[model samples]
Target: MDDKKLVKTLFMVMTHRNEQVGLSLWNDNPQGYNQYCQWQTIIANPRAMGLGKRYIESDLNRSFNIPNPRTYEEKRA
Candidate 1:
């Protein structure tokens, strides 16, 4: 099979979950998608694999150069 044919034959799926928001997926159907299922398993058990947890009070994207860092959040900036 050509590249296009092979790609078409393969099954693909993507899923995401946000605590503040909700669950989402690119392919709503997951039946017979072994690779996709394996990926979800890894994501679900991230802590078991030594992954870091998300910050609660502060956003990592907001930290940048500032004249004065007064508060704990500011110091992180």
Candidate 2:
């Protein structure tokens, strides 16, 4: 018999690439950053952030429901 506790992973998705709040939060707290290493954090639109825009083709926040996924944001979804 195996008895072990499972820790559920936290998924922090940066839907809006233009927002730097999360980055600031992580940078401000070293302890939080250490804990964050165990969680899944995804920068949904890296290209959008690089280009200084909210998104490239479409908004990633709404792209998750896309069926065909034609645009870059849709593909990212």
Candidate 3:
């Protein structure tokens, strides 16, 4: 997520795989920023597709903001 230009970001939080979006803070940052959790969470997420930097190149890697919740698009499948 840091490597590519962030098309968007949610300072609060996002969804957890197999669960629901905005269910909870995936993991508080060192400064308590409830972002997309740690780097591991990004890789571990089923939604992440394990693409890493390549994930950024794909359309799914585009920023997904949970603020809008269920209606927004994210390649959850």
Candidate 4:
């Protein structure tokens, strides 16, 4: 019921299933989380929705701070 206990329980469950509740390098989970945040905020602009925005490189982390980068804060600004 408490946040700690809930997190522990979730962690155990995820660990048992070889799943992670956090970002995964193979799945661009960071970008996914960023986009999800953008959707929930007023900063949910076209750029936030994966529009006009270009990822010159396919690296999400690299794209994380490219001036008009695509990270959670950028999207949720």
Candidate 5:
């Protein structure tokens, strides 16, 4: 089977660490879960999640494409 065919949807669970709705969807529905070959949950900021904060140094959402990454979030980006 084509690798592409296995993933019907790419669920990108970004930003909020406390949010488990996306993971719950992946776990609750076995039939739907099978459609995705890869782990669907994409946690954008592990540091923020670990710290129980929205971000460490800077807002991750706005840190992307930064030339000189000075902050933790910027470095992650």
Candidate 6:
């Protein structure tokens, strides 16, 4: 099947897990803003296709607001 067909199949079957709504961060610098948008797109679409960026044990979505992070993932927050 083609890429579009694969994406459609994934969406229809609901096999994806921990799928959160895509969020784009704001960047003050023009170049930085563009880069942020690009990165967000890169990460979001793959997850939409059932390819999550982080392992099932880690939740990148929850990493951002963490305080005094301990694990590598928390520090990555």
Model 2 regions more than 4 Å off: 1-4, 25-37
Per-residue lDDT of 6 in model 1: 33
Each model's C-alpha lDDT?
A: 0.31, 0.64, 0.33, 0.29, 0.65, 0.35
- Expressed as tens digits, the lDDT of each residue in 25-74 for candidate 5 is 54554334444464444566777677777677788779889998899878
TM-score of each: 0.22, 0.65, 0.18, 0.18, 0.57, 0.28
For candidate 2, lDDT tens digit of each residue in 6-70?
Answer: 33344444557667767654444423223224344556677887888888998887888787899
Q: What is the lDDT of candidate 3?
A: 0.33
**Selected candidate, larger TM-score, 4 vs 5:** 5
Model 2, 19: alpha-carbon shift in Å?
1.6
Ranking by lDDT: 5, 2, 6, 3, 1, 4
Global lDDT for candidate 6? 0.35
Total residue pair clashes for candidate 2: 0
- Please give the RMSD of candidate 6 to the true structure: 14.8
Write one digit per residue (lDDT tens) for candidate 4, span 4-77.
Answer: 33321111111111223331432342222232231111122323224434222242333334567455434333
Whole-structure CA lDDT of model 2:
0.64
> Per TM-score, what order, best first?
2, 5, 6, 1, 4, 3
Error of 6 at 56 (Å): 7.4
Which residue pairs come into collision in candidate 5?
Answer: none
Task: Kindly list the per-residue Cα lDDT of model 1 for residues 1-77, writing each as its tens digit.
Answer: 24333322332211112231211332333333343232221122122123233433343345346576553334544
Q: Give the Cα-based TM-score of candidate 1 against the true structure.
A: 0.22
Q: For residues 37-77, write the lDDT of model 3, one tens digit per residue.
A: 33322322333333322232233334365444342234331
